[model samples]
Target: MPNDLQRFVFVLFDGFSNMVLASALEPLRAAKGLPNGPAIDWNICTIDGAPVTSSSGLTITPNASLSQISNKADIDYLVVVSGYGVRDHGTAKVRARLQNAAQHARHIIGIDTAAWILGCCDMLRGKAATIHWQELDQFADQFPDIAVSQDRFVQDGKLITSGGASTVMELMLHILTQQFGPAVAFDVSNLFVYDAENQYHLIRGADWLQGSGGDDLRRAVGAMMSRIETPVSLKDIAKQAGCSLRSLDRVFHDNLTMSPGKYYQMLRLGRARDLAQATDLPLSAIALQTGFTSSATLSRAFSKTFDTTIRTIRKSRAIR
Candidate 1:
């Protein structure tokens, strides 16, 4: 709502990966909590004013249809998240609409098979880009004039292209790093426990992490995520993460600016918030799932951490 906010329009098609969309958007959501991070706003859109289902069968009701995206509004970024059935989704009708949207968008990003769609719109005319690796050969043959790369994500001028879910996250963090700084990106990546996985380099090559002791913090956070329902002691968590409790505390303090116990509580409360926002399960069930002894105890902690009652938040979500 701020005047300096950057507006992002995400155009999602049928059979898109909700995970990929989350990978791209969650970093920006986390960045908003930073003291001086890039201020941004975003909307999800579809080709028509209809709900579209992801490849995993989750349906999403977008904020608006592509046609509703008036060119009068300043469009700072346009990200197209495409997955299965990408070829058919990029029809002439869709291309026309996307071209009109791009005219005002300062930065254009393509995820998964979205590069193909952008190419169809002539948005990536001379940009070196990539798509999901499965379509690398087809992409090369189809667009011989456009130089293709096997990297996870590539940026040329104002256009960006990403391969898959993990790369989408990397690309987003890259953008955050460029727009704000690496500290903001690192903090956001740490929130998601990004360093626990070993499979990220399969497509993207080596990681950007430069052994700055972030891996240890990520491991500790990963341990916390793993034991959210049965919260663990700082000593046990440090041991699981191959560090001493004191070292773990220092890592948490230095990197996250919180004590280990405090971070753990925040993690558990975050899980509670997600469950409360996204599910119909009762408070007792939610409390049990997030390691709370009872609904009353969970309610107090949730209200204290989030500064809002669960009932009020749920009612607000329903109203929206």
Candidate 2:
């Protein structure tokens, strides 16, 4: 790595989410691709230097041990990517190590369950944050001081957090755009064939359904999620719910505070985001698979909603 490169240290714990790791790292790689691009450096690390396995059984070898890097002053960011047994890893030793790293690092990022680690480290106290949807209840129960939200991601000053794998790529792209200009970020996105306009959101599964107007709304949302590749219209969803379009709209307003059409679009976009962040599928293919008529259409709508492009989303994933 170049001497002037920004250094990023991604902390991996056992049973980490591979998707989160990919979402966090890919954008940095994309940043390096731009002409006269600023140098960016990243390395994977664990409590020890030993290889750690992902929740999906993918094993990754770390570049160095935490002990070696904990006190290093050169690191710019220390990102903890965790999943599953996050509470189990909240050992005193790990907490101390994180605190030591935070002393030197310019920023600390937590993805998915790793947010729990940050909370346990007392780094997220009183900060507005989010975690994976499934763990929201437990997270609140354990950390009452933290103001958690259902948003896809949250950034409180230098401490950034995402709900989980879904929001990790979005968070990374946000960082990339902030560090590198939109033009360089766009170039990086182009290489990945991602739509250039979709802003990333950190979504928790529960939030996706919360406030949905009762069983009718829940069923509509569920059907939409299950059939993202073949999106159904509001009218169709309303028919399935044995309600008229007007009734559907009223229910949606009562439950989700959005029209049925908007809800469906959000559902599709959410699924599209997950695929973009978690898979290497071409942008066009992803668009088609997510029920968009074309990549351009998806790009337009996604950008309108997310304020970023698809290319950036994919580029972010690529860095991971």
Candidate 3:
């Protein structure tokens, strides 16, 4: 709606995650807040231009109906934000509206369960996309034509799909980087206190570790992260990070209140937890991926750290 600005249209549906919507929109908001920043305009829209309710019982009023913007050249991107019970609310009219919008928009991005709708419309055919981890199995099975990834976000061709929430922030930052520059993106990340290294994949409790510790700590953690599948020894981690084993131990003690080995194990276990929950991969495969020598080792470490077995966690999530 603003003049001479990069325009984005976000299609909201019932039960959408407010966090995902905010994470995607906030970077643009931060950019606009910057002094003499370039213009970037966005509008919330629905199929019928009505108010939509989020999963958390929050209501959002759309700026315009999907049909109102027929001149696709005016819009830079169209994103669909849906959640929880998306399948229940999606109608033929909604699909038709998206199909019409896809004809005009430069790119179509899907968040959370929106990929399911996009797949239903046959828009993701031959494209690599990702959806919320919980739906990955169903998505792959339901749409044989789509290439699904477990990455937090996937941008294949003109189509972009994000897993959800925090991942949406990464997607938005990427969009900003493309539209403006890395400086703008970096500044925007600072505004949100976001860690860019945690882009699509990240450690579980490492968010708090960001910028609090010294560079050596960050470097050591980075090294550990980069070698999750084939874990490097602590001596190697310290050496590559330009620190002694004792120095690395002290840094971890001061920052994370644990030894470097324990912290790195947690990181690997975190990755194992993610893979175990998000993927249909076998326990043995997950073990190798997360640096455990065997499935039994992974199970023992997982139970020790989380106080629950990986199988139990997966089963509970499956039941939910």
Best by TM-score: 1
Residue range 46-142, candidate 1, lDDT tens digits: 8786898999999999988886984559687799999998888768889898888887788999999999998888887777999999999999998
lDDT of each: 0.80, 0.74, 0.79
Clashes of 2: 19
Q: Tens digit of lDDT per residue, candidate 3, span 104-167?
A: 8888999988999888777999999999999999989999889999998999988999888888
Ranking by TM-score: 1, 3, 2
Residue 239 accuracy (lDDT) in model 1: 89
After best superposition, candidate 3 residue 232: deviation in angstroms?
40
Model 2 agreement with the true structure over 74-193: per-residue lDDT tens digits: 678889989988889999988998888888888888888888999989999989888999998889899999998888888897888887754776676666656654434433443454
Pairs in steric clash, model 3: none
Which ranges of candidate 1 are over 4 A from the true structure? 1-3, 34-38, 194-320
Ranking by lDDT: 1, 3, 2
Model 1: pairs clashing at backbone N, Cα or C within 3 Å = none
Q: Report the error of model 1 at residue 32, Å.
A: 2.4
